[model samples]
Target: MARTTSLSGFPEWLPEERIVEQHVLDSLRRTFELHGFSSIETRAVETVEQLLRKGEIDKEVYGVSRLQQDEDSSREDALALHFDLTVPFARYVVENSGYLTFPFRRYQIQKVWRGERPQEGRAREFTQADIDVVGDGTLAFRYDVELALVMIEALSELPIPPFVLRVNNRKLAEGFYRGVGLTDAPAVLREIDKLEKIGAEQVSRNLQDTVGATPEQAEAALSLAAIRTEDTSFVERVRELGVSNNLLDEGLNELAEVVGEASRRAPGKVVADLSIARGLDYYTGTVYETVLVGHEQLGSVCSGGRYESLASSGKKTYPGVGLSIGVTRLVTRILSRSMAQASRSVPSAVLVALNDDASWSAAQDVAGQLRARGIATEVAATAQKFGKQIRYAERRGIPFVWFSSVAEDGSPTHEVKDIRSGEQVAADPASWQPPAEDLHATVLRAATTDD
Candidate 1:
C-alpha cells in the first residue's frame, strides 16, 4: 500500500492559517468599506467567448469541462475560469449597467484560476484582491490617482515595510516606442517586459531582432526605462533625454498629474517608472506594479493598470482603473521568511476540560459561560485524565484550561491553569475573565534579519 499526496497548485491551509487568512480578508473588506467601495461576487464560470473578448489573457484562462467522468463526448467548447477578477467584473457591469451608479466603486476578493505552470509565488489557483471604479461614459482621472493612494494607505497598515508602487502609462510606452522609431508599440512593450528575466543585453538584442530597432535606438529606450527617480524631477529628466513627441508629452503630463495627486494624498508611495510594461493587453493608460522593500527579487506582489473600456454593449461604455494585490503571494513570502507567526493553533482563548465522565456536564457549563462572556472556548469531548487533557490544551495552544471540580454535594467549582507560566488558580466559572491581551492570539515578532 502507498500513501497519497495532496494535489499541487490547490493549496489548503490548516485552521490557524485559515484564521490568519480570514483576518487579512476582513481587514481588507473593512478598509474598502471605509473608503466607500461596495462589494460583489460573480459566478465562477463564464462563456469562453466572453473571456476571449480581451485578447492576450485568454492563454492563461482555465476552461471548465467535465472530463474525468465522460471523456468521450464532453463539449470541448470551453467555459473559462477567470484568470483575474477584472474581466468578470467588466462583464458584470455591462450586464447590469442600467442599475449601477456612475463612478461605481467596488471591491472584490475572490479565488481566480489560471492554467500557468506553478512556481514559488505563481499558482494555478490563487486569490486576488481587486478594487475598481467604473464610470458610465468616461472615468475620471482623479479617481485614477485616488485609487492608487487608497491601496497604498491600506497596505501600509499591514506589517510589511515601505514598498515601491512602480507606475507607468501605456500611452507613455506607446509614445516612447514611436519616438524610438518603432511602429508597433505593444510589440516593443512585450520585449521590454522581459528585461527583468532577460539581462539588458538580451533585451536589447531582442528589441533589435524582433521590433527592428537599431542598436542605438534600443540603447536609448533601455536608458529611458532605467531612469528611476523618487519625485517629479523624473518628468524633466525624460523630457531632457530628448524623447519629446506629441504623444510622449501628453503621456508625461498625465503621469505628472497622477503622481502629483497621489503624492498629496499618500506621500512617498507612488513613483513614475518608464520600465513598467504590464503584460496585460487592455491597460490603455496608467499601469502599476508593487514591490516589497528588500524583496524586489520576489517580483511584483501586486500589479494592475487602467483599462479604457472593459464592458461594451454597443450602446454603452465603461472605463475603469484598478489594481489587485496577490494576497497569497504576500502571505507565502511572510511565511517563508518567518516574518510572522500565528500565536495559536485555533481561535480558542480557553479550553474547558472533561476531567472525568462525571464532570462532563459541569465542564460544558463552564465552556458555555466563557463563550457567553465572548471568549472562544471548547469543552473536551471525552473525559480524559487531567494530565492528558492538559497536554491536549497545550498542544492546541489554548493558553488557558479549566478543570471542573465537583463540590462534596456534586455541585461544581472551577480551577484554571495558564499553561505557558505553569500556574494554577482557583476560579469562579461565571466571573473569571482572562486578561484583555490574552483573549485572542496576537501576531508575535519573529527573528529579525538586518536587511
Candidate 2:
C-alpha cells in the first residue's frame, strides 16, 4: 500500500525547523526558571472522571482505553489524554498537597491532545507552555501580577513582535451582568465572549433572545462590555454605567488592583478589556488573552484566567491562576511568515573527514582532542572523495570541515574550511576554534524575491 500522507494540522518539521522549535522551548524554559518557577510534568493520561470534573473541557477531550483488555468483562479502567495542564496540576496539588510547598509556582511545557477539528493555527496535537501559582489558600496578589509579567518577558524573547495581554475580571463581568438584570453568570459571559466573532448587534440580540434581556438593556450591557478605556478610566467608565450591584463594585475593585499592578510592571502591555471574556467557564476573577500586534487576526497566542475552584472533591475548593502559550499555533505562524529560525543541528563545531582507511584511526585522535576541548566533532562513516565529504557538511549546515591528509613521508596534517565562504586554513586540531557567532546558525529574515 502507498504510504499515507501526514495528516493536516499535524506538523512534522525538518531538522532545521526542529532546531528552531527547540530553541524556542529552551528560551521559554530559561525565562520560567529565571522567575523561580519549578518544573513539573504530569502523566499524559488521567481518568475521565478526573478530567470531566470541570465541565468546560468535555467537547475537546480525547478518551483512551485498552482495546482488548475486556476478556473477563468484569474489571474496568478508563482514562483520557489530558487536554490542558491546569486541571492535572490541580489534581496533583490536591493529592500531593502534603509534599508540595505552599504558594507552589510551577511551569509545565508539554504536548496536549485536543479532539477538535483542525484550523490554521489550532491543531489536534499541540504543545503548550503553562505557568501557574497555586497556594494553600494564601496566594499573594503579587504572584498573579508576576505570572503575566513573566509570560510577557518569555514571549518577547521570541522573534515575533509585541503582543497585547488583553485582561478582564470575571467578577467585573458578572457584577455588571447582575446589575443589568442577568442571573446566569457563565451563560451571560459566554454570550459576551462571542462579541469578537459576532457583531455587537447580534450579541445584544442573543442576550435578549437567549438570556432574557430587554433590547435596550442588552444594548446597554453590550456597550459596557465594549468599553475599552486605556487605564483607570476603564474602572471609572464601568462604574459610570451606574450599575448599582455591590458585586459589580467588588469586581471593578479586584480588576483595578490587578491592572494597576500589571501597569506598574509593564506599563503598556496589559489592558483592561471588559469585552475580553474568555469562554472558559471556570474563571471567577481576573481573565487574560494575549494577541500579537500584527497578527491579531490569528487570535490569541496565549490565554488563561483565574479560577476560584479548580478541583472540588466534595470537600474543599482550590483557587488558582495561570496562563498558557499556544506553542504550536505561534510557532507555525512564525514558520509560515519566516519570522524565526535555528541552526541545522546541535553538533558543536566540527566534522572530521575520513581521508583513507589507514588514516581513520589517526583522524579519531584529532576528533578525541576536539571533543576534550568541548567541541562537538564527528568523523565521516566512509572514506569518500573530498568533494563528497564537503557536500555532506554543507548539507547538514555544518560550518567547518576538518580535512585530514597523510604526506608521502607518513606525516599527517589537518586543515579546516568554512563551507559558506570556501575559506580553508591550516590548523592544529587541539587549539583551533571557530568564531563564537559562527558556532551556531540562527533564524534569518527571509530575503526579498528580487534579491
Candidate 3:
C-alpha cells in the first residue's frame, strides 16, 4: 500500500548520505571518548511539566497521549517527546543522582523531535550529538575552555571546511545592559540576538520599546555585540565601551582566559565574538557558536554554553558546561551541496560471481575463504552470466569480482579481477588483502563547482 501523501519537516537520507552521517557520528564519538566522556542516552519522553520547565518552548513540543476506550488522560501526568537532549539529561541526572558519579562527563547522540516549521537546515526530527560535563554544586571553568578545544579537535578531523568557534560571555551582555541602566537584560539580549534576522534598525527599536533602553544604550549594546577578536584583545574592546560592573569584569576575565588558551593551543581556531548572545534563557556564563569558513549562511552548526541549576536536586545544584553538534543538519548540507560523498555505495568490496547454477556452492566456498581473511565478500544472488555479474558489481561500485572453478585435479581454483583497473590475477583467498582504504566504503570530499 502506498501513502497518499508524504509529511513535511521530516527528512530521510539515501544510502550514501546515511553512510556519510555514520562516519561523521563515529568520528565525534571517538573524539568524545578520547577526552574521557562516557556515552549516555535518555528516554525519548518527559513529563509535560519537565519539558515546560525551561520556558515558552511549548509551541515547538509534541505532546503524547493514548486514545482508547478507557484511557484516563487525567489520571496520568502529561508526556511529550523531548525537543532537545539537555533537558532530559538533566532530569536523568536528578533522578539518578545517587547512582551517578559527581562531575559527570557524558556524551549523548540521539534523535530528538520538535513540531517547528521546516527550513533549509532545520527539521522536525533530527540527530544531535552533545558532550557535557556537570559537577555537583560547582563546575570548573576549565571545562568551558576545554570543551571548545575538544569540539575543534573533532570537527577538524571531519571533511567539513575549517570552522571558527565563536565565544562570548552572557555576563558581559547582561552586565553591560545593567551598567547602562537597563534592568531587563534577557529581553534586551533577545532583541540583540535578532540583529541579523530583524536588521539593526528594528532591533534598536525593540530594544528601546521593550526594555526602555535609551538610544545611546541600545547602540552601545549593538557595538558591544558587533565586536569580535581572534585573540584576547576582545577584553580591551569591551573595556573601551566604558561600561563597568563586577559581572562585566568577571565575564571579561573568563572570556579572555578561554580565547587566550584557545589561541595558544590552536591558533586561529577560536575567536572571542562579542555579539554571540545566546537567546536561550539557561546559559549563565561563556557561550559558543561555530561557523564554517564559507558556509556562514548555514548558521551555527554547533552551539552550547554553561548552565547553573538546570540540573539539580534541592540539596545540590549541578552546574555544567557543554556543546552540541547538529548532525542531521550537517549531513543534509554535505549531501545537498555535494561537499562530501562515500567512495562506494555498498559495503562489500568483492562480489563472488556465479559461473553456473551448479557452481553456486563453489562461489559460496570462495566467499567463505575471503571472509576468513577479513575481506567483505558476498556471493552472487543468481547464476547470472559473467558479464552480468561484473556489471552488477560495477553498478554498486564493488571493486573486485571473483570467479571460481574446479581444476583438473578436482581442487577448486579461484581468480580475482580488480574492476576499477581491469587487472586480473590468480590468488589464494587466505592471503589476499584489499588496500586498507578500499576494504570498506570511505567518506571523501567531493569536487567543488570550480574544480
Candidate 4:
C-alpha cells in the first residue's frame, strides 16, 4: 500500500501503483519515438543565473552548494536544481549546437523541483515528460500544430479521462493587449492568466490597478480572452472585437492555422482557448495548456509553448515549439481517483511447486523450460506443502501454478492450474502458454458505476 510520508512535497507510490506509472511512461515513450523525437537527459543542476534568465521563478529555485566550504574557496559559481526541462534544454542546445543537427527534435522525461505549496495536483518534486523541436534559425509555425497533435495522441493512449489541449498565441494576446492600450503586455498577460483562479472581476480590476488599463481597455482585454472555438470561426470572432494591428493579423493567421489543422486531424481534442496566457515570460509565440474534462479543478495536467529567443548564440538563434506532460500529477490523479490499476503486483505468471528437497532440481528444470518459452515462472523457495505454495502464489497474484510429479509408469508429468478459475490441465513446459493478458503486468481501467 502507498503510505503518506513526513516530507509533504514528495510523493511515493506502492509497487502496484508504480506499475500504472510505468505503463503511462511506456505509452508516452512509444508515441514520441513514433514521431521521430530522440531522447536526451540534461544534468539536474544548472547555474542559478542560467535558470533565472528565462523566467521570474526565483523563489521556487532550489540552490545547490557544498555544506562545508573552505575559506579560500571562491563562491563565483552557484548551482540550482532545474524547475522545468525547457530552460535546461535551451542551454543544452546552445552548448551542443555544433554537434547537433538543425531542427533537432528531442524528448526528455525527468524529475523537476519547484519550491511551491504542495497541493492535490502540484508538488515540489515531480516528473515532466517534454517533447521539443528546435530549429537553427527560424522554425515553421506548423510545428506548433504538430506538437499539439502529438501530445493529443500521447495523452489519448493513457487510461485517463478526456482532455482538452487549450492553445493560444502570445502574439495574439500581446497584439490584442497593445491594440487595447495595455502597454505592458506581459503584465497584462500575467493578470489575465489569473482569470480562472481569481475570477474575471478581480482580473479586470487588477488590469486597471496594476497594468494601468482604463475601464474600457480592461473590458476589451477580457473580451478578447473570452473568445474560444473549436475551429477557424475564432478569426471572425476576434475581428468582430475590432482589434487590428500588423502583429494581431499575424497572430490571428497563425492561430487559425493551428486550430484548423488540429480540429481536422483530431477533432474536438483541441480548443482555441484565448484565455490561456501561459504566465511564463519565455513564451513569445504559441502556448498550450491542457485540462481533464471533468477534473478541471486539478489545474493543467500538461503545458508548454514556443520561445523564439530562449536559446541563441552570439549571431545564431534557435527557435522552438514544444509541450510537456505532468507525469507525476497525472499519475497521482489516476491512482487517487481509481481510474486504473495494475493487474497484479508481481510479473510472474506461473509459480512452480516444489514437492520435496530431492525434487527441487527437477522443479528448477521445469521453471527453466517455462522461462525459455517466454513465460515468467518462479520456483518455490522451499519444499512446502502444495496448499501453502498455492497460497504464496495467491498472495502475489500469480495466475498459474505448475506441478511436477512421477506418473504410474514412472514417466514425468506436468500440470498447470489457473488459481482464479480453479481449472487444472496437463501441460508441456515447452509449449504451455498463459493467456495473452497474463504474459505481463497490465494496467486495467477501473469499472465505472452509474451515479
Candidate 5:
C-alpha cells in the first residue's frame, strides 16, 4: 500500500465512503433527468472577470496561472477555478445561446473549488449537484416553483433525515425594506442574512448602525424575518405588518403561488420562510435553504435561488431558477454521524476460487460467463488453499464464492457458497443468479440507537 498525507480542506473518502457518495450522485442524476433536465459539464476554469461579475466572492475564487512565464511573454487573461456551477452555467448559456433552445434545462454534478477555511461541511474542493432552467429574454414564475418541487423530490430519495425547504422572495424583502424607508435594501439584506448566526438583537443593531436604518425600520425588518409558515397564511401575516409596495405585492403573489402549489404537490416539504434572505444579490425571486431535521448545525445542506440576468448576450438575456445540493457536505455529515453506509466496500458480488494452477483457466472461464450475465465476478490471484481463498473473499465483503471441480462422472461441477450464511449449492455460471439485493453495493441507512 502507498503512504498518504491528508490535505486540510480537500477531502478524500475511503472506498466504502466513496460508495455512499456515488449512490447520492446517482440518485440526484436520475431525479434530475426524470424531470427533463439534460446534463452538461462546463470547464473547470473561467476568466476572473467573468467570475467577479456576480458578487463579492473574490475572496473565495482560486486563481490559476502557469508556474513559469517567459519574461517577454504577453500577459494573458487571468483565470481561476470556478467557485460554483451557476456562474459557469451563466457564461455557457451566453456563449452557446444560438444553438440551445429556449428554456434550456440542465443538470451539472461537478467538483468546484473555493478558497475557504477548512471546517466541518466546508471544503476548498467539493462536489455540487446543480439543476437550472434558463430562458431567452424572459423566464416564467412557474419554473421557480418547478425547481423547488424537483429539488424536494430529489432530496426525498436520499437516506438522510427528513428536511424542509425554506423559501423566500428577494422582491418581497427588498420591497418591504424600501417600504420602511430604507434606501439600501441590499445592504440591509446582507445584515439580515446574518440574523441566524449573530442573533436578532445583533442583526437589529447592525441594521441601525451599519445600514443606517431607523429603530422602527430595524424592528419591522426583524418582525418580517420572524414570519414562517407551512402554507399561504404567511401572506396574510405580512399584510398585517401594514407595509405596502407594488414590488411587495408581486413578491407576495409569486411566493404564495410557489408555496401553495408545492404544498399541494409535496405536503410538509415546503415552507414560506421570510427569514431566508439568501446573501447573494443575484437572486431576484424565490430563494431556498434546506436543513435536515435534527441536523440544523450543519446549516443548509442545499441552497439556491432565481437569477433574472445572470446570462445575457447583446440582444438576448437568459433568466433562470436553480438549486444546488452540497454533496460533499451531506456525505460528510452522514458518514460522521453513522447515518448511512455501503453494504460492501468493493463492487464484486462473487469471487471464483482456483483449486490449483491447472484450474486457473477454468476459473477464468467461469468468471467470464458470470461477467457476461452482469454479475460482478473476480478470480482468485494465486490458487491458494480453499479456506484461504474464502477468507480473502470474506475480507473484501464479497458475499458469495464459487468453487469448480471435476465430478466422478468426468463432468465439470460448480457450487457457490454464501459465506455469511454458510449455504452452498450447485450453480451454473451461465444460468445462476444472485439475489437482486446482492447484485451491487447498496447504501443502507444505519439503525437508530438509544443515547
Candidate 6:
C-alpha cells in the first residue's frame, strides 16, 4: 500500500477547523433567515450553454462526463460543474417562475467549482453563501442598499478580519468609458479587471492594443478606478471629472442612494470605489468588492451585485441584487492566521465515566438521558479508572466527566466533575444541563494587544 497525497487545491479541514467552519455557516444562516430570506438549492451541474451564455470563461469551467459513454447516450451537448451559484440560480428562477413569488428572496449555500489556478483564498472547489432578491422584470434600488446592509450585518458576527465593502455601478464605468471614446467597454472593463494583477502599465497597454484606447483615455480609465471616497462626496468627485452623460447621471444617483443609505445605516462599512468594474457582464447597476482591513492582498472575500436581466423568457425578465461570502476562504484565513479558535475539538460537553465493566450499559443509559435534555454527552468507551477516564475527557477538551453511583438505599445518583476547575457536584441526568455558553463548541478569537 502507498500513502495518499492531498489534492493541490481541494481543502480539507481537521475536526477543529471544521468547528470554526460550522460556526461561520451557522452564523450566516441565522443572519440570513432572520432577514426573511428563504432557502433554496440548485443542482450542482448545469448545461454548458447556460454557463457560457454570458461570457468567455471556458478555461475556468470544469466539464463533467461519465467514465464510459455509449454511442447512443442521451447527453445533449455537454454539462459542467457550475463555476458559481449565480448562473445556475438564474436558470432555476426562469424554470420555476410560475410557482415562485413576485419578489423572490433566497439564500443558497453550496459548493462551487472553478478550475482557475489556486492561491491563498482561491480554491478549485469552494462554498459560497449567497442572498439574492430577485424581482419580476423590474427590481428596486433599495434591494441594492439592503444587500450591503445584510452583508455588513452578517460579516460583523463572523470571526474574521474587519472588512470594507467597495461599491461601484456598471452604468458609471460604462458611461465613463463611453464618454472617453471607448466603444468596446466590456473588453476595456475586462482589461481594467486585471489592473491590480498586471499593474497600471500593462493594463494601459492592453487597453490600447486590445481596444484602441489612447494614452489619454487609458489615464482617464485609471484615474476613475483610483477614486475612493468614504462619504457621498463621490458624486461631486465624479462631476469634477468634467465628463457628463445621461447614463452617468443615472448611475450617480443610484450610487448616491446606495452609499448614502449604507452610510446612514451601517456607518463606515461601505465606500464608493469607482474602479470596481466587476468582471461579470450581466451586472448592469451597482457592483461590489470587499477587502479585509489588513488582507487586501487576498482580494475580495465577499462580492456580488445587481443584474438588470439575469433570467428571461420570451416575455418575462428577472432582475436581482445579491451578495456572496466565500466560506472556505474565510475559514482558511481564520485558521491560518489564528484569527479564531474553537473552544473544543468535539461537541461532547460531558463524558460519562464508567465505574466498572458492569456499569457500561448503565453509563450508556445515563448518556441517553443527558442527551435527551439537549446536553451533548458521550459515554466512556471502556471501563477505566476514574483518573484515566478524566484524562480521556481532558484530551478531547470535554469539560465535564460524569461518574455514576447509587445511594445506600439503591437510589440512583450521579456526580459530574469539571476538569478545569476540579469541582464535583451532584446532578440528575434528566435535570442537569451545561451552562448555555458551554452547551456546544464555540469559536473565539485570540485576544490581541490592541484589545
Residue by residue across 1-451, what tens digits does model 1's lDDT show?
0111166666666666665566667778888899999999998898888787776776688878776655454344557788889989999999898898888999999999988777667778888898999988898787878878888877875555568888887787789778878888888888889989997899999999998999998998888888776666778888777775788887787888777777666667788888999887888888989998788887898788889877777867899989898987776666667666677868798888886787678777778888888889988888877788889998888999887776899776778899899899999868898888788876654566214
Candidate 3 overall lDDT versus native:
0.86
Candidate 2 vs candidate 6: the TM-score winner is 6
Model 2: which residue pairs collide? none
The C-alpha stretches of model 1 lying farther than 4 A from their native spots are: 1-5, 68-77, 264-268, 408-411, 447-451
**Per-model CA lDDT versus the true structure:** 0.81, 0.80, 0.86, 0.92, 0.92, 0.88
Question: What are the TM-scores, per candidate, against the unseen true structure?
Answer: 0.92, 0.93, 0.95, 0.96, 0.97, 0.96
After aligning candidate 6 to the native by TM-score, how far in Å is the CA of 303 from where it should be? 0.5
State the lDDT of candidate 5 residue by residue for 211-276, as single tens digits.
998899999999999999999999999999999899999999999999999999999989899999
- The positional error of residue 330 in candidate 4, measured at the CA in angstroms, is 0.8
Tell me the tens digit of each residue's lDDT in model 3 across 193-212. 88878788999999888889
Evaluate model 1: give its TM-score.
0.92
Q: Which residue pairs show collisions in model 5?
A: none
Residue range with the least summed lDDT across 10 consecutive positions in model 3: 1-10
Error of 2 at 168 (Å): 0.2
Clash count per candidate: 0, 0, 0, 0, 0, 0
Q: Look at candidate 2 and tell me the lDDT of residue 180.
A: 77
Q: Please report, as a residue range, the 10-residue window in candidate 1 with the lowest summed lDDT.
A: 1-10
Q: Tens digit of lDDT per residue, candidate 4, span 1-451?
A: 3777689989888889999999999999999999999999999999988999976889999988789866665434788999999999999999999999978999999999999999889999999999999999999988998999999999999988888999999998899888877789999999999999999999999999998999999999999999999998999999999987878888889999888999999998899999999978999989999999889998999999999989988989999999999999999989888899999998899999998988989999999998998898899989998999999999999999999999999999999999999999999998998999999989998774111
